[model samples]
Target: MNWALTNYERLLDLVWQHTWISGSAIALGFALALPVGWAAYAMKSSPHGAVRQLSGVTVSLSSVLYTIPSLPLFVIMPTILGLGWLNPINVLIALVIYAFAIMVRGVVDALNAVPPSVLDSAAACGFSRGQRAISVTLPLAGPVMLAALRVVSVSTVSLLSIGALVGVSNLGSLFTNGFNRNFPTEILTGVVLTVALALVFDLLLVAAGRLLMPWNSVVSAGGSA
Candidate 1:
């Protein structure tokens, strides 16, 4: 408590750094995943044998990316991306890769969960593929996507701390510093702050989802009643 209070400004800076890295990675990953997931989902049903294989290939590759060890990935990012070892972008890039790998599958599942009957109705109503995707399918998949985003948000927040291992400063630095100095308070503060940050992100995501999908709230209320 004494150290934290004395170093309050430094703690706040690290928290800000952690927030930016996690938030940017999640946002970028979600943006990239949407179209790729749609492509993979659409390709699954293609008449061409090779085209249909694309969906499986895409998902398998994403899973493989997720399986790669994060520490090594962080260390290698500088060499791979031509950034300096200490550059913050190294952490950002590594985090983005991880976020994308996790979110792509979620996007595919969300899209697949949309009812076929609803898609057919959209088609019958003369909606083009793009129109149906944007207007009907996406709205229907909102809850599932929201669930995925929440997961990504929390996971990214938790994961970003690893960046500190490679000289990239974030909340994880506290852990390393505390361990070196044999100070439990610093380590506890890091753990508590990390957990609290993840929870805040999750709550914000839930609030945003409810605000954007009032019908989902109504359905839940009706189900409970």
Candidate 2:
């Protein structure tokens, strides 16, 4: 407890850095997943099936990217992006890669979950591919996407702790600092703070989804009755 109080300011700074990094990764992943997912789902009728093949390849590749251990990826990012070993950007990119790997599949699944009949209706009403995608398909897929966002957001917060291993930028540093000095309170503080961060993110995602998709809650309520 004394160690935690003594290091409170530093701990707060690390907490802010950790949150920022986690949020950036999730945001980047959400942005990139949209197009990748659309391509995977929409490229089915291309000549010689090249685009479809590309879709499969992308899913495979994202999975492989995520399978790489975080420590090695963090260490290797300097070579991959020519950034310094401790550059927060390296952690950012690696985390984004991980978030994307996890969310891209969810995006694909959500988009595909839009019913064929609803899509056909949109087409029959003279909606173009892009129009149907924007107005109908995506709206229908909102719940799934929100669920995916919730999952990825929590996962990103948890993983951001690993950035401390690089001893560069994050809450994980608290653990490292604690262990180095043999301070149990510092270690406990790190664990509690990270868990709090994840819980906060999860709640925010849930609230945002409900706020953005009131119809979903309504439908669920009606179904439950």
Candidate 3:
């Protein structure tokens, strides 16, 4: 802690870079996930079995993207994107892909979890497809979607650390710096701050979800009663 305090300014700069790289990727990933998730859910809900097959295939590809080894991706992203080897943009893009992969499937599952009766009720009310999706489906699915956001945010923050191995300046750089100097404090600081960031982000998502959809809790409580 003393060592960290001594170098607190440097640490703050790294934190800002780390947060920017990871947070931007997460934001982009979440934006892309909405449509991908909707497509998966829409196909699955369709009567055509072949169209349903596409949904499974889409999600499987996302899972595959996530399973790729991170170090190699960091190394190769520069060549693939024509960027400098150590550019933070490479790290950002890589994290975005991973975040999108995780959230897309999660969002699909959330949409699928919407009760059939509620869907039918929405339809009976003469709700158009767009209206039902925006008003009824997304509102009811908020809990699960927010749960996905929590997981994706944490995962993105953690995964972005891997980019530091290739010289991207995030919190993960502390591990490298500590190792080179054989100083445990730097490494420990990284671990603590990274975990703290993840926890804070997760809690914010939970709070936002509850605030945005108070009716969800009310209905859940009534259902239990």
Predicted structure with the largest lDDT when compared to the true one? 1
Q: Estimate each model's TM-score.
A: 0.95, 0.91, 0.94
lDDT of each: 0.90, 0.86, 0.88
Q: How many clashes would you count in candidate 2?
A: 0
How far in Å is the alpha carbon of 53 misplaced in model 3?
1.8
> Which regions in candidate 3 have their CA more than 4 angstroms from the true location?
219-225
At residue 19, give the lDDT of candidate 3.
Answer: 83
lDDT of 3 by residue, 49-138 (tens): 999999899999998999998889888899999999878999899888989999999889899899999999989989998999899999
lDDT of 2 at 158: 85
Weakest 10 consecutive residues of candidate 1 by summed lDDT: 216-225
Q: Could you tell which candidate, 1 or 3, scores higher by TM-score?
A: 1
Q: Cα miss at 114, model 1 (Å)?
A: 0.1
Residue-level lDDT tens digits of model 2 in 110-172: 987888999999899999988987889989999998888888998888887887787677888
Q: Kindly report which residue stretches of model 2 are placed more than 4 angstroms away from their true locations once superposed.
A: 1-6, 45-47, 219-225
Q: Cα RMSDs of all predictions? A: 2.1, 2.3, 1.7
Model 1 misplaced stretches (Cα beyond 4 Å): 220-225
Question: Which structure is stronger by lDDT: 1 or 3?
Answer: 1
Clashing pairs in 3: none
**Model 1 lDDT tens row, 1-225:** 888899999999999999998899999989998888889999999999999998999988997898989889999999999988999899898888888898889889999999999899999999998999899998888899889888889888988888889989999999889899999999999999999999999999999998988888773434544
Score candidate 2 by TM-score against the native.
0.91
Error of 2 at 57 (Å): 1.5
